[model samples]
Target: MKYIVVKLGGSTLEQLPPTFYKNIVELHQSKEWSPIIVHGGGPLISSLLKSLQIETQFINGLRVTDQNVLDIVEMVLSGSVNKQIVRHLISAKGNAFGISGVDGGLLNSQPVEGAKELGFVGEVVDVNTDMIKEIIQKGYIPVISPIGIDENGQRYNINGDIAASAIASALGANLCLISDIPGIYIEKDNIKHTLKNITKAEVEAMIEDGQIFGGMIPKVKAAIDGLVHDVPEVSIINGLEVDSLIAYCNGEEIGTKIVLNKESSYVK
Candidate 1:
């Protein structure tokens, strides 16, 4: 069966319509493609951190997660965010099991290069593919929270995009980044046009030219990183559109597909 790893940003999850969840359930029930979800809860985490009067910081888009912040992060991600996604799936008549990277050591991680600055932030060292596969085999969609744990029992905050990329790589699945916008766009003569396809090199060039900026940088970077690690395909699509996820799986060309090489890209 074909597998697709869907990365749902916390910023967009709450705004996503019930039909989005229904489409996910439909995709899961289909004989062709199976859906696995990896989700983020940054907005909720930030709101909680703010309410608690805890100072938070970020460097290079990675949160500087101290012990206290890590506790809150885990609670929001593993507890609330993960279960919320599962509930959505269940409400749509889908069987979904929610788990964190810490569960069964699903994600083995180590401190990132700048861990001293970004405390408790980790990069995925390994993924428990067997455990994930077992969950899928049991007829349940795996809703994963991006929290990694090391051998020493220390949990780390992992970026949702990074975690999804790693999982997609491990499973050799297509990675779909669910975004609020239709796709990456470029401005020309005061008009913004969504790209049908983009290459890694082109993405880098766009970034260098300042055409792609802000939060989009991390998303494209994660897609490029996934391609480098052998994920067959990665696309950024708007979750708000009805059947967007299903359309993507059916190769309907609704979003910007990212590939490693120019030759691998379609001439759209």
Candidate 2:
């Protein structure tokens, strides 16, 4: 079976409409492709932290997850957002199971020792794809939360984008990142959407030209990483559009396709 890994950003999920969920249900019912969902809960976690009166900080756009903040991250990601995605998928008639990086030692990680201030923030060192494959084989979509456990058995908050990329690379599956905007734009305020089939070289040029900066930098990097790691292709599609995913997956020209230059000849 053709398998795809989708990473849904927390910002995109919060903005997702009912129609989007319905479309996902339809996609799940197709029986043509199997999908594994890795989701982020940054926005939700931030809100919860504020409600609990915790100060938040970021180092290089990654949250500096202190011990208290880590607690909130666990609660919101594994507890609320994970279950919500599962509930929505199940309601749409798709069999969905929610799991965390901590569950079954799915993702083993280590602290980013270079940054002393970012407490409990980790980078995924390894992933176990056996359980994921088993779940996919059973026709169940695995909804994953981006919470990793260190070798010392301490839970650490991981960046969702990194988590998704690691998982996709391990599974060697086509990866798609669903977000609120149409794929990476050449000019942020240009208003005219330019969905070019990009190569890693083009992405680097865009970054040098300041077109890709800030939040988009990491996202584009993740997509490029997937392409380089033999995943075949990775795409960035707008989550707000109900049929965006289906259109892209069907090669219907919906979003930006990031491909290695070696593979460009086959895209057309």
Best by TM-score: 1
lDDT of each: 0.90, 0.81
Please provide, for model 1 over 1-268, each residue's C-alpha lDDT reduced to its tens digit, 9 standing for 90 to 100.
8999999998999999999999988988986888889999888999999999999887756778999999999999999999999999999999999999999999999998888899999889999999988999999999999999999999999999999999999999999999999998877678788888888988988889888876677778889999999999999999999889988887898889998776533222
lDDT tens string, model 2, 1-268? 6778889999988788776666666666677777889998888888888888899977656788888888889989999999999998877777898999999889998886654888888878888899998887787889999899976789989888878888888888888899898887654344555665778887788778777776677678878877777777788889898778878778787677887774431111
How well does candidate 1 score on lDDT at residue 82? 93
Model 2 error, position 185 (Å): 0.7
The number of clashing residue pairs in model 1 is: 0
RMSD per model, one decimal: 1.9, 3.1
User: Please, what is the TM-score per model?
Assistant: 0.96, 0.90
Pairs with steric clashes in candidate 1: none
lDDT value, candidate 1, whole model = 0.90
Clashing pairs in 2: none
